[model samples]
Target: MKVLLLICVLALTACTKESEELRMRVQQSIPVPATMSQVLNRGILYPTAGIQVTGVVRVVQLSSGKQLQIDSFSITPGPDLKVYLSQNALPGNHLNLGNLISNNGHQAYNIPANTNLSAYNYVLIHCQQFNHLFSYGKLQ
Candidate 1:
């Protein structure tokens, strides 16, 4: 029994170490037209329990449409992470912007032209597989 417990502990530690080293880096700089040089709303991201998140999130007006931009962003690596534009800080009643591109970097998600920013004003990083809220930022 002692040997089995030791094995379990070792396995858990190995898994944690592996996850820490596996960071997916991404960069997506969406170009805004020179004429449309406006940031309609912006906010700072805050981490949730057991997570570390740092970033400036903003809504930029574009010639084509609006975009949710994350700059100088980094987050604790997790499986099945997704980007969401939510009505609340929590996950319910949200727009699934799609899978998070990376654990760290500048990334952008296009906001549908029809989306009402006043209603869905909170940006969230969620773990869809586990239904976990990793971080959130409310646009003001």
Candidate 2:
């Protein structure tokens, strides 16, 4: 039993290390676009995965208007993930941006043209199928 448990622990550690290495490689490869010039707000996403989630959430003013950008973003991948602009830390009273496109790297979600930007203060990465919050960054 002790030997088996030790083996499992070692295997899990190896897997975690490999995942971290892969995440770093992907993040390093994403180039920030020059068109992302008008930064309206910024926040640092915090992990709710019980593992490290690192990224910057930016509200940028594009020619089309305001949109949210997740830059150099990474988090543990899970199923049925979605993004939200919320008034609270939890998922309720939220504006569902749509399904998350990737578990790591840069992505953007559009804010409705009529949205009152000041009303929502959090950018949430949530697991809709499980109703779980994966992480969040407070909009500033």
Task: Identify the leading candidate in terms of lDDT.
Answer: 1
RMSD of 2: 7.9
TM-score of 1: 0.75
The backbone clash count of each candidate, in order, is 0, 0
Q: Report how far residue 104 has shifted in candidate 2, in Å.
A: 1.1
Which candidate leads the pack in TM-score? 1
RMSD per model, one decimal: 6.2, 7.9
lDDT of 2: 0.84
- Per-residue CA lDDT of candidate 1, range 1-140, in tens? 99999999998887433342243322224332233448999999999999999998998888788888888899999899999999999998999988887788887788889988889889999999999999999999
Question: Candidate 1 lDDT (Cα, whole model)?
Answer: 0.85
User: lDDT of each prediction vs. the true structure?
Assistant: 0.85, 0.84
Q: Enumerate residue pairs that collide in model 2.
A: none
